[model samples]
Target chain A: MCQLLGMNSKNPADIGFSFAGFRARGGLTDDHVDGFGIAYFEPTGLRLYCDNRAAMDSPLAELVSQTRVKADNTIVHIRKSDDQLLSNAHPFTREIWGEAWVFSHNGKMTIKDAADSDPIKQGKSRHYCPVGDTDSEFAFCYLLNQLKEQFEYKPDARTLYEFLTVQCRFLANYGLFNCLMSNGEWMLGYANTLLFHVTRQTPFGSAALIDVDVTMDFETVNETDDVMTVLATTPLTSDEDWQQLAVDECIIFAEGHMVYQDVPTRPVYLSIEEGLKIAKNA
Target chain B: MCQLLGMNSKNPADIGFSFAGFRARGGLTDDHVDGFGIAYFEPTGLRLYCDNRAAMDSPLAELVSQTRVKADNTIVHIRKSDDQLLSNAHPFTREIWGEAWVFSHNGKMTIKDAADSDPIKQGKSRHYCPVGDTDSEFAFCYLLNQLKEQFEYKPDARTLYEFLTVQCRFLANYGLFNCLMSNGEWMLGYANTLLFHVTRQTPFGSAALIDVDVTMDFETVNETDDVMTVLATTPLTSDEDWQQLAVDECIIFAEGHMVYQDVPTRPVYLSIEEGLKIAKNA
Candidate 1:
């Protein structure tokens, strides 16, 4: 179990207020002291910070509070790995699609070994490859590789949306593969076990971290109409409304506002090429 | 041992050709293959991909080569660990001063235990918090912490320029800590044990990766100046005029060019706060 925090806004913004409370639940006040990380997308670059240490103890968390390294998009994670999961599956790792991709998850997943499920015959494989033996990270790489093989490097935005929805549905069947991803532009949130979100705009209100007493007056944080969406394994605030994510559901939030909502039907395993056909047909 | 590939250009460009050659050196054609990572500063944010596996075998590396993730600034490294540094002390990590800072390094480092060198209770205690347990990484956090303690946040470029040179000089004495750092605007490179660089611009010649034969005519590149600097633990190419760094010296490169150089009389041993004072004084 882990907690995830994300924000997408029209204008660059820091997630210190909401992250403050979310981090407490990971450890400190709560018991999530496994590891923590934060990613901020700046102009043509990113400020990504991670620590095998807890968020509360992370030098990054402290810096996030004091300094505003604003970004239009951001995702944060507080990991809680029980003995059931392998330590190798920690929320940070690199995945390959048509481009270098980064992924972090906040749930448990049991991925299949390709050798057992689908053995490679000779030198013939244009699909996914798993470098690490972790399930969650494997799922991320597998999903992305599927997308890559199907689209062959370029997929329209609409096609990407449908493909991702299908992939999310597929992941939901295997325990919690709840995830968040960014090519560093838009923030994608998928939930199976538990997750919540709140988007702030005009006439915003102050919110408190559920685990911590820290609160910030959103009204005083500039009068601009900025939309910020927050995601977590559980609600970080006692007072705010955190919409529970149904299995096979995903939401695309960009520039701090929700843009796409996907409630998938059922997940059926498909070949990488087959998945692309679905995208092309859709 | 590591291989670092960096590109700085007036316009965003795809680093596929150079990366292809550089990636091959990672435990394939040559040896430095313990881990590898590459980061791209796209038009809006950073797209980073890394793996603790051999770059030659990484699907992530293959994707990076096939898909052109164009960017203005990029850094890639293939690792062969000599110090047995843990992942926490690995080349990729973020440290903060005011703006978000990114750092990566090549080569081994001789880290002195503060407890070993500095007499305990022999003087008033100084405050220093290490974020990780590697000498290379410790130097990164220590430099930033020192700078932050003095300036708090947001210091000028000149101050930063001077401070980094002195700090690099100190860092170089502790064995091989050759490094590269960027704040998404300007880049700084310090050559300690062995690091080489090449800045390409108009009338550029055909440059090829030493590890692989992938080559491109810089003349065809769409940049006012195709300024690129390649730094590595060992010389990657035989043809290029690689500069051998002077022992115990630091060199500053900004905006595709070199601006300052420093050769310290002796290692500057000062408190974190005192070091920041130099940046402030500058």
Candidate 2:
């Protein structure tokens, strides 16, 4: 599998503090060394950095960690490749209705089954398709195509949030579907099993990393009005109260606050034998 | 206006040597310092680095100059933004047929003219549109939309090349239209006024930079079978025999060779007064 990290802020902010620890998992602290990627949305424009090299040793990742590219929304991913190719690197991006939509996944799905039922193959997903051969990208294309089919242009925020929650449930049925998606204006996070989030507001304090010997004093760097929320596959900081999400839960965030959330009415779980069958086909 | 640089190679190659001098024009040597961007096609995937900071001072650009990221096709642009916004940065990319088509322009065109006739505005360009408000991106969207309208999937190389040549002529009629576009497989360069190209092959030798105090001995690093072609708004090296394109000529390059060329039969030059009017509208 892979790891995911995301941030949504009321003001432009840097992820260097969090990224420093998150990237250590790419090779230094853990075994996910296949590749890593990150996407930052500076309002309407986007800055993306991706490398097929291990983030622990990648020069680009080093530069990213040192440079403070401030943005309101950001997503990062580190991969342990089931398919060893640069094309399958995470944080895949696509444009929809003149807005760039970025996505990264942290779990596995049955590629053969997804492709067999792909709307793109059925000629319904004419507007978007996956550039890489990853099941994650295929799932993203399907979801975007469904959105395009439902609305000629972007729908209201509430409508979009509701539609995505229903779609996330359907996708989770295929396999473990933990994902982070953003379109510059808002961020949507879905947890099939493991996900955690933490919000830092006015009374910001010092936070220490769980993976590295690094600590950041937020009070010194941030204004009193600044608010930021971070989401990750695993908690990056040891001192913060990271709220864990339940299985099949989805949350939408904007301007550092949770605007909407959907908690599954009845918990659904897949057995180990069923998961093994999907993995074998994949 | 912006500076454009592109590379097409027979083998995966690093462009650090050429990029070093080109980036100097962003601030140190010239005044095109509003922003800069570069795209590297990694076979089936893409790696893009962009900043709304001066390339001469950007740490990302410094890292790129030192890191040897090998790619078969690469495009870089340094901008002097008439409109100071990150969304207006160069090398705008959109996906077509599951392949990223990257584009950057060096001169201005009348945005009003392009928008009036935009296929997307007419409900025809369903596959792609511009995320930013720039004449360059508007023109790119127009070109890509025309291509998608002509072919359901990617056409043969020859057919696509021929169609692009005709389209370039039409776009050049609107205003100054020197541009570079690529789809990883091939590069197409069109010039309304300024464009130059140089191809380095088996007998490669030392080359001196034009904007920086740097010289590279290519023979030490390249194999005998290596062939690489570079396109730029101005020649980067002082020692190479760079060929200038005619006013309305388009060249298609693949594997460091020019596979096709289209020259206008009769040049249509816009008068200074007419160009001023278009610039004012833009």
Stretches of candidate 1 exceeding 4 Å from the true structure: A82-100, A112-115, A118-132, A264-282, B1-282
Q: Largest DockQ belongs to which candidate?
A: 2
- The local distance difference test score of each candidate is 0.61, 0.83
lDDT of 2 by residue, B1-282 (tens): 678899998898899999989999989988889888999886647888877788998787888888888888999999876665778887888878888789989787775555655533454336676778887887888888888878888888889899998878887776678889988888889987677899999888989999999999999989999999999887899999998777788998899889899877875554435543443454
Cα displacement (Å) at residue A278, model 1 = 32
Second chain alone, TM-score for each candidate: 0.78, 0.91
lDDT of 1 at A213: 72
Instruction: In candidate 2, list every pair of residues with a backbone clash.
Output: none
Cα-based TM-score, every candidate: 0.49, 0.92
Q: Model 1, B130-175: lDDT tens per residue?
A: 3334455567765765565566545787888888877776665655
DockQ, candidate 1, comes to 0.02
